[model samples]
Target: MTRLFNEPSQFADELVKGFVAANSQWVRPVAGGVVRRAPTVEGQTAVVVGGGSGHYPAFGGIVGPGLAHGAAMGNLFASPSAQQVHSVAVAAENRGGVLLTFGNYAGDVLNFATAEARLNSEGIVTRTVVVTDDISSAPVGQEHKRRGIAGDLTVFKAAAAAAEAGYSLDEVVRVATEANDRTRSIGVAFSGCTLPGQTEPLFTVPAGRMAVGMGIHGEPGIAETDVPTANELAELLVSSLLAELPPSIATAQDARAAVILNGLGSVKYEELFVVYGRVAELLEAAGITVVEPEVGELVTSFDMAGVSLTLFWLNDELEGFWRAGADTPAYKKGRVGSPSSASTAASTADTQSFAEADRLTLAAETAASLPTELPDSSDASRDAALAIADAIEAIAEVIDEHADELGRIDAVAGDGDHGIGMQRGSRAAATAARSAALNGAGALSALSLAGDAWADRAGGTSGALWGLALQSVGAALGNTTEVTGSAVATGVSDAVSGIQSFGKAVVGDKTMVDAMVPFTERLSREVNAGGDLVTSWRAAAEVATAAAAGTADLLPRMGRARPHAEKSLGTPDAGAHSFALIVVRVGEVLASRHSEFA
Candidate 1:
């Protein structure tokens, strides 16, 4: 377990601070993450890469002369907020356009896509390359649905190299896409990792057994079996990747690949070498020539005792870029020439000034702007805002009370962060709603602000989904005189639709949608029958609770849990349960405040 940490919530921030201090020669701190201390060529495309924290050397550690220009670091196992990504991108941007690259997880996709849109809106050209190289997350036909794992390094390196070599933004994107398509990775874990302050690991493997196709986020593997010998493990990894060679590679005998035997966290370099030795022998036996193979921790999950192998199929152009010189704090290759003196001086000054200015701007923008006194809105609007605040406060308390239970449920088949994420999001949302209410914002505005805070603080798949749901509902609520039963029902319907659209999860996917759809349907029906807000919401909450309980009998069909669907059969989805709890608690608050409407 992670013994070293001041506070669980402050871990990511402190890690970044210490990292920048220790690697001053290579990286400098920005508002959201780290940027290269050494300036890039002016008008050259900048490659920005990032993801959740705990995956060191992957993101921040790779920011330097020949790798990522900047990295938008997030909380542990969570994607950075869109604001964080945008700030880092702005600090990293030069005359050339920017190319954003990261793992293909839901939160990362949502936030990165949001950042890309925002950048383009601001007239800063931007492109994105989502790395999806893990073969275990999806089938061959649904490759787009696969999650990114250790192969993030290969794709990021290729993009960064192309950018460093003065490729256009489009060309850099092309190369990164090709790298992702040609690369394949598979991982195995002896044990799961623990988050800071958490006494237990996310998941556990039985003694004398190992998990195959395990994700880096402490998610249980798809299959578990007796631990194999070093040679056998290596063979399993190689065979799995070789079985799915990219179309560009004509045959195994004729393939040339750049291989990476990556340690997740606690696995030592000696063990990696032992595995790589066997891996190299097998590849040679298959007549594949391995290029400069890397064996060490590149992407990690806290202190997970696991390893993943990545094979990047190579052609002439890819091999050239793969061998290109790189000088980062944690990774370095062949020597790279020094930048021009004039450009270096100018770039240094520009970087310092831009970083400082952006930091101040971000600080100002993020600061709370609560009013000392309520604004002069309608009395009905004020009452509605207060009611919303009360509901959110109730929701927060309920989530906090059951957070541990929810985490336990999630750990059965997923990374066990759902409870913590929901707690964080709900607390942030409650605080934001209270502040907005104090400032005399209408119900719609308050909820919208709350949604933003939830997404910003939570920083995960659930966080993003909740944020979208709340924002969609708030938009449907509007800022009119008073919130009516019809409006509330319409808002709930809109939220359900938004979540389905955003996550692509249907009602039976064993996600929050399972509960949410039932709740929305019931609420709409009750409201259409001329019921009051409290009555309709209470009825909907009951339906949601039953629907959530019913999820115990269904198989998971989405997210990380999909791979371990059978394991999750007897457990309720953490998200669905939490949603049910929140709605029920909020309904109680609504009932208590029914007098306000009267």
Candidate 2:
């Protein structure tokens, strides 16, 4: 278990501070993440890669010459917000467009894709290539859904090498995409990891057993077996990967592969080298050629006692790129050419100014998209805004109260971050809503600001979805003089519709949508029957609560939970439960102190 932490909530930010301080030669801090500290390279396509924070060398550690130009670091096991991605991209100097790359996860996909759209709209010409190289996450013919793991380095390196070689954005994306297609990885864990301040591990393996096909994110392994000797374990990993070579290699005898025997976290280099020895022997016996194989920690999962193997089936072009040198904080390869640098003081000042300019530009562009001024509202509407603010603040309190339970529920089949993320998002939303209401803003403006705050502060799939839901409802409510049941029902409908459209999750997915669909349907029915908003909301909240409970019997069809469908069967989705809880509390607020708004 983690022992040192100022605050579990501030861990990600605090570590980044120390990382930048120690590695100032390679990376400097940006608003959301980090970019190379060296001089700017005009017109070079910036290769920005990122994911959750625990994976050390993966993201921020590899920000330097011949590697990722920037990395959008997220909270522990959470994807960064779209705004975070955009800020890092802007700071990275997008003269030749930007190539966004990361592990293929739901949250990362949504957030990065959103940032890509925004960057392209700003004429930055951003493109994304999701690394889907882990063979365990999905089966054959479903490779697109596979998660990226230790193989992230191969894709990131290929793309960054191409970018440093002055390839165009399209070409860089192509190289990364090809690298992802060629690479495949699989892992096993002997023990699970504990997040900071957590008393227990996310999941545990039985004694003397190793969980096979485990994920880097605190997700439980797909299967378990008695632990084997180092050679036997190596054979398992090597044979597993060898069985699923990319289509380019027809036979083991005909192909050369770049091997990566990666230690997850606590696994020592000596232990990895022992495994790699057997892995190399197995490959040689199979008549395969290994090229520049790596045998140490690459992508770690906090303190997970696990290791993974990656096979990058190499062609001539890929071979050249693989051999190319890179100089980052953690990983270093052959000699690398350095970019021109300004003196320490001058460079710091210049880059700080550049980052600020980029930030201001992005803020201006975003402001153009959102309304700059709050709408004029009647006294009644302003009064309703106070109720909205109070309801949100109440949600924050409730979420905080149940955060630990939520985390446990999520850890059954997911990354176990739902509670932390929800707590952060709800608190941020509440603060924003309260401030807007205090400033005499109407319901529309208050909720909209709250949504943005929730999304920005939380930075994950749930965050984005909840943020959009609030924004959609706000749009439907507008600045009407009086809040009516019909208006509330319409807003709820729009919220559900917008969430479905943005996230593409439907009912029975075991997501929040499962509860949301039922609640919205019931609320619309009651409102159409001429019921008051308070009564309709209470009825809807009941339906939602029941629907959330019912999710326990259904297998997850979406998000991280889908991977361990069986493990999650007895537990309701954390998202659905949280949504139900919040709506129920909001109903009480509307029914009690805010009946006039209701």
Candidate 3:
């Protein structure tokens, strides 16, 4: 368990602050994350890599010469917001376009894609290469769906080296994509990791047992077996990766690979060295020549007792890039030259000004996307806003009550952060809604503010999806008048459509969509039948609750839970349960306050 922390919620921020202070020679703190203190090369593409915090050395420690130019650090086990990514990218870019690279997780994909679009819109050309190297996440046919793990280092290094070598943005992207395709990783855990201030780990392994194919974020492994010796474990990792070679690598005997024997967190260097010993012998026995293999902590979970092995199949170009010199706070290879004169401090002011301008432009674009015509404040609008505020408050309370249960359910096959995320998001949403209402905003404006707050505070896949749902509903409920049953139905329908479009989860995916789809259909039907808001919402909430319960019989097809799909069976999805709970509580609020709005 993590013992050192002022507050669990503020841990990520504090960690970053301390990291920057300690590594002042290599990194400088920025608005969203850290950037290299070294000067940027003119016309060289900036390689920006990032993900959730807790995976130390991975994000911040890798930011320096010949590595990531910047990293957009997010909350622990949560992807950075699009705003965070954009801010870091803008600060790091040097008029030479940008290459964004990160692991292939849902929240990271969504936020990185958003940031890429925003950057391109502002004349800062950007391209993305999502690292998908964890073989256990999906079958070969569905490789695109696999998650990135310890293998992230291979892709990030290649892209950063290519960028530092002055490769064009397109070339940098090409090399990074090739590296991702060629890399493969597998891992095992003896025990799960605990988040700060949490008394329990996300999951637990039976005594004398090891979990195989475990994810770095405390996700349970796909299988469990009696703990093996170091040699046996090394062989297991090597065999698993060798069994599924990339198309470019024909046979183990003819392959040349770059290897990384990475400690997840608590695993000591001596243990990694022992494992690497057998790993090296096995590769040589197979006639494969291992290049400068890295054997230490690279990517990590919070004190997880685990290790992963990454094999990066090498070509001539890739070999050169892999051998390139790099000097970062936590990682260094060979001797690196000093920064060029172009990277002088004089350009710092200019870069800061440019970054600020980009931020203002983004803010303006966001404002323009919302409704331009503001409605006059009236008694009906004020009352509707108040009711919306009340509903949010009720939802927050209900989520707080169920937070522990939801976290437990999520720990079965995930990182066990869902409950905490929902609690944080709901409370933030409620606060924002109440503030908006008190400031004379209507229902639409209040809900919109709440949505923004939820997304900003929650910082996960559920957070982003819920934010979209609320914002879509707010857009449907125009601020010009009081919301009626028909308008409410339209808003709910829009919310469903938005979530589906954004998350790409269908009813059988064992996600919130399982409950949301049924609820929306029922509400639409009841409203079309001339039912009032109270009756239709109550009926829809019942359907949602039942649908959520039904998820226990289904298999997970998305998110961190998918890798351990079997473990999730017979357990209700945390997201689905939370969604059902919130809607049911909100229905009660609407039922009690309907007459005021009417």
Candidate 4:
């Protein structure tokens, strides 16, 4: 049922509509979605910032009186096409020359470098500055490979201030580069985002799990683990960024740094501040000083539920500029502070809800119980399931290689992770499942082993639910040498019943039951209707697919995401999609092996 959009060949056109609407006073679309507006100044050095969209306010919001004059906006999470970059330079250049800056990513490097050349030919001078703050992107030896995160804010502010202070374009670029070199950042994702008008998310984070070092878009993270609490999450992110901070910065007497607590769209501000408070406390304890802490949605991914913390090791020059007066619709510090005084007085009479406190406690407890060690890989069924896990692992590698194109497909429905999570979980499961599979064990036995490994190795509410489902199915078919449609139906029924009992959820819960319940129900109808196993399975698969589709109409009612159930009505549950895929694939496998069964 998923289909691709063909109307807009390029994303820039759609985004420019929004950009011009938002900044008509200060910005105008010049060429190729590039905004030509600059902050008020004359004969002053200029700083230019740009990158793919979806990380909003980065290149665009940073353009103002105390910021860059013009910004070159790229497509969503993709580098601007070379022609687009070239056109932007034409609009941004002046007598003071232009200084270009963006995060350090391969596509960006290639595009910007090309733009630099084209600009020179036009007789406009331009220089480049790259930010490398994500320590996890590269090992210590390959620091250049790391991509910029929140730290880009500091570099932009400093660069802009320098340009406004009458420094030459060369000096501005140098100062900006220095700020980037001294800044670092790290992030974790709880959920993914979707492109505008896309029904499905680009990536997925399994329930009760988090993706550490997640890319600005839905790119893969360093690892997926049990979801951590605000405090714990802050601790981990801060520790990672600090580990990579220049030791001199940490030990210096003036080891002051500014923190930009960035929200990846849809994350509530209250939660962000909670995390920020902890980050501030931790840094203070570690002999680091926190300068003016900026907390808000500065950069975003359509509707992703994640956060990234950026720290800029500041010197007097940077600090002075950071505090210097500047105003933009999104990045203003002065107007924002003034409103709080009046709003706080009006809201004080209202009672604060303690609901977040309860949720926070539960999340912390859940994180603590996650499985870190893999279960024994000695069982045959476990091994086969692990093979499926291996299939999932292969998928992640595929995604990493094709990251540039993933958003196009994933933006349609369900988070694109049908490829990523399966790859990660299956890979982990296979490593544990293979020990038993290699012994040439029977199908049912391998599956049972896989169930155990999956439950133990995967660390989300989904993993636990799935592991339980598989274990129930394995138990129903104990000692069976092979699986037939009847056997599969029975296993599926038992698995569904087992999961339902513990989770106390129903078919319309927008969970896996959306697919499983319908498939099992149809399987029973087919067998009673007197069809052979294969025909019965095919019928059941059809039913499962329909039921999964039906979930798009039902809201999630049982889980951490329950509050978002209504919003999810038009999107199928991720678990349901996974189940449907498994059912369809299993049916195909059985059909192909029909002769063996006979």
Could you say which candidate leads in lDDT?
Answer: 2
Error of 2 at 506 (Å): 2.5
Candidate 4's error at 549, in angstroms? Answer: 29
lDDT of each structure? 0.85, 0.87, 0.86, 0.64
lDDT-sorted candidate list, best first: 2, 3, 1, 4
RMSD of each: 3.6, 2.9, 4.1, 21.1
Which sections of candidate 3 miss by over 4 Å?
218-223, 251-255, 337-379
Give lDDT tens digits, candidate 1, residues 196-309: 767888878888999898889865556888899999999999999889988777899968999999999999999999999999999999999999999999999888999999
How far out, in Å, is residue 507 in model 4?
48
Tens-digit per-residue lDDT, 1-598, candidate 4: 1133333223444656566656544455554343433333566766767876667777676665666667877655555544456656665666778787888764467657767877878777888888887776667768787777777788888887788788887788878878877788887898877654355566678999999888675556788889888999999988887777664475634488888888988787999999988998888888878888898888777678988888888888888877766555457654212212222343323212222332364355434433433344324334334443343344334433443333332333323323332333344445544554455444455556566555433323444466667667656544433444466567778988988875667977777788888888989878767777778888898888888778778867765335344446567676676667666766665565454331
Instruction: State, as a TM-score between 0 and 1, how close model 4 is to the true structure.
Output: 0.55
Off by over 4 Å in 1: 30-32, 218-225, 253-255, 337-362, 365-377, 595-598
Query: Candidate 3, residues 1-598: lDDT per residue as tens digits?
Result: 7889985667787999788767666776776687887778789999999998889897999998888999999877888877678878988999999999999988999988988999999999999999999887788899998889989999999998999888999999999999999999999999889987677888888889998988887565568899999999999999999999999888889779999999998899999999999999999999999999999999999889999999999999999989999988888987776532333343656556544654575466456434555456667777788889999999899988887788888888787777777877889899989988887788788889889778766777888888878888877776777688888889889998888888889989999999999999999999999888899999999999999999999999888888678878899998999989999999889878988544
Per-residue error at 577 for model 2, in Å?
1.0
Give TM-scores for every candidate, taking all chains together and pairing residue i with residue i. Answer: 0.90, 0.93, 0.88, 0.55
Candidate 4 segments whose C-alpha is farther than 4 A from its true place? 1-11, 34-40, 247-254, 334-598
The candidate that wins on TM-score is 2
Residue-level lDDT of model 2, residues 360-398, one tens digit each, is: 754665565355577898787788889899899999999
When 3 and 4 are scored with lDDT, the better candidate is 3
